[model samples]
Target: MDRGGLVVELGPGAGGTTRAILDALPPDGRLLSIELNPHLHRLVEAIPDRRLIAHRGSACELPAVLAAHGFAAADAVVSGIPFSTMPRAVGARTAAAIAECLAADGRFVAYQASARVAELCSPHLGTPRVDTELLNFPPMRVFRWERTGG
Candidate 1:
């Protein structure tokens, strides 16, 4: 959150947001992208950046993934997963992982078409700061959840 040392992006489909996050990183910054789909994972992996680690994994495994990458926690996490369409149990598990894997001052950010993530993530990620982006084709909502006393 504060200048970004290690960033994690969940479900980086086609690398659109990946490019944005990579560009925002400082020289010492690194981004770990977790994409489940083989095709989309390959697309993100094709991006030529020394700082990007495109992994074929699910967000539910974030703790293990980060540990495998030699990171205890992330500075910030960005998710593109559509929690609204996913089963509540699955979404809760992934959301919990995001919270647990975040550093003390870490942030959990999500860009979703619906507001479902606000309810799904708040219990773990604390209060959310939300904004609407009407510029997109279907107008998506952006939610940033920061860590607080849990």
Candidate 2:
């Protein structure tokens, strides 16, 4: 990420991806991670990066989360959420909040095991393009949804 830019992360179940994001972030950049499960939130908090903020909250609470953290929008967002396994309505609601939080040129990157997530996010995040990460256990599909408009 660009130096000093803001990036939001959702469902950081484990610290693996969180560590990767932190490593990639420029010293001045920040990553606000929202984890629905308190247990997982604490695990993410154990990551020692100065740029990371681990919050215990649902993705639906994104607006308030950002506001409380002094962020108006994000340069980029990442999610490890399993939208396909979640309630469609809840996924849509979370997607809407993410749409509102993204900067004009920002992208929402999701690691999905199914196509349902991309379909669910399309209305709020625009169509997503896919890439495969073959090295993963089940081979992950990475979907990227860019901000819908300029």
Candidate 3:
């Protein structure tokens, strides 16, 4: 992130990524984390940080969530949502919402166990750079895309 820019995180399962993002953010920066599961949302809300706004909602409502939080656009978005397991229509909507809410030149990064995310987001964000993290248990695919010119 760019010191004081805004970042949105999708599906912060247990708040591990939420804490990591908060640690990297500057005091003036903002992090809006959306977690659909109430149990996980509480875990994220427990993080004692002024810059963090943990909201319990579905990732498909990214644009609305950002707007409700008074965020015009996000500098970046990090996702841990299981795109491979979600219904195809839901995944498509979430991907479209992510693309619409990001700032020009903003980046979207998805950590997934499969390439389903890339398949779903390609139409909106273009092709993403794909990499595999061998260290993560069962390995994981990292897909990244950067929006240009809004």
Candidate number of the best TM-score? 3
Candidate 2: worst-modelled 10 consecutive residues by lDDT: 118-127
Clash totals for all models, in order?
A: 0, 0, 0
Best by lDDT: 3
Model 3 backbone overlap count: 0
**Cα error of candidate 1 at position 74, Å:** 0.7
TM-score-wise, the better of 1 and 3 is: 3
- TM-score ranking from best candidate downward: 3, 2, 1
Decoy 1 TM-score against native: 0.94
The TM-score that candidate 2 achieves is 0.95
TM-score of each: 0.94, 0.95, 0.96
- Per-residue accuracy of model 3 over 88-125 as CA lDDT, tens digit each: 99999999999899899899999999999999999888
Cα RMSD (angstroms) for every candidate in the order listed:
1.8, 1.3, 1.0
Those runs of model 1 whose alpha carbons end farther than 4 Å from true positions after fitting are 1-4, 148-150
* Ten residues in sequence with the least summed lDDT for candidate 3: 1-10
